[model samples]
Target: MEKTKVFTLVFKTLFFLLIALFFSWGIWNGYFSMIFTESERFLLLLQQHLLLVVTSSLMAVAVAIPLGIFVTRPRFAKSEWFVLNTANLGQTIPVIAILAIVMTYLGIGFNTAVFALFVFSLLPILRNTVAGLNSVDPAMKDAAKGMGLTPMQTLWRIEMPNAMFTIMAGVRTAIVMNIGTAALASLVGGGGLGDLIFAGINLRDNAYLFSGAVPVTLLALTVDGLLRLSERIFIPKGLQEAAKSA
Candidate 1:
């Protein structure tokens, strides 16, 4: 354990050092000059990008979690295939195509982007939720019933805790994907770092391209890291130890 901790510390230190070095190189090469030259606009686009990610992710969570839970219930077991396939269909469709369809109906804007993103982000989370719950031990559920616990009690106390790590894994996947997809929102005038990215492409400007690409990459990494930390904090300690052992 001590060796593990030490290795982790060393790894983190090296990681941060590499990030610092990369940014310093970017500064030297003027790759990030747009941030300084067009600070206000850059900031605005960044804010819009974050808003797009947060709003859509939250919406996905709200809809997906319940839908996932619903389809997992024994009463709805027969419908699970249909629901999963529907979500899978949404995911299988190209995100750009989804955006285009949404744009056709909504006529483009932040709301249009959010709706499209919400659709795109739903499947992973819903699938994970169902899988996590389904993976819970039947013996455990039986034991809870023998103890006279109500169905709801068993679900909340015995099931959800065990399933949380998997569900959160899905959420992390969805959110990280959403962050990257949000960049495409610029194509529809949804207003985000995509504006910079597409602009750079059209104008053949490296600075504009890197400005958008770097931030999107960093944001995804940062959010994924935070979600991992949250999983560590929120997942039951016994499960964490069990996971490590596994």
Candidate 2:
């Protein structure tokens, strides 16, 4: 590889290493122990938090992508605004309100919290997907159709590839939001980092609160970074370069 490429790789590696080291130093001094005590289930809470976020984000992607695609069709073109507005309306409600409503009907548990988080995570993705697909060059779409590609083939090969970065942006937003919102799950008997923070609040312990909050923040950052990496990997090289330049 060229010297410039080698230097860039080394720099990126060290940057991440520094972050790992920072966390390691904090852990070494018992900074993390404040949350992880002899009997405390810190790891379990962390696991639950991650599970909720991942599951809810995945569910949102599954629904939002298809829904976004469906609404952009000619048959649904006139109703697109109505459907998107409905999704926008969902976002207007407070997440806690949505959670409570679901809890009331669905009962308190992991599943209910997931449902609420899924609702909260939907708008960004749905809006971005529609916008992304719509933003595709109409001429390119026509060209695709003229080349004997079926509608679905044109969408899959031309539209989605061109729109991938935008779609991934939506996915990234939802994932981060999902992570933060998943903390609320604890309020409804859904175990997660939020339980720790709430427990610390009740007990007036800063350590416990930071323990939960810090990890959640870090988790969000890590996930966001991973998504960016995934986007770079999946995005067309020319588009990636264009994005970087822009």
- What are the RMSD figures for all models against the true structure? 2.9, 4.8
Clashes of each: 0, 0
Error of 2 at 57 (Å): 0.7
Which digits, one per residue and each the tens of the lDDT, describe model 1 over residues 5-107? 9999999999999999988998898989998999999999999999999999999999998998888888889999999999999999999999999998999
lDDT of 2 at 58: 85
Per-candidate TM-score against the hidden true structure:
0.91, 0.86
Residue pairs whose backbone atoms clash in candidate 1: none
Please report the TM-score between candidate 1 and the true structure: 0.91
> Highest lDDT: which candidate?
1
Whole-model lDDT per candidate: 0.95, 0.89
In terms of lDDT, model 2 sits at 0.89
CA error at residue 148 for candidate 2, angstroms: 1.6
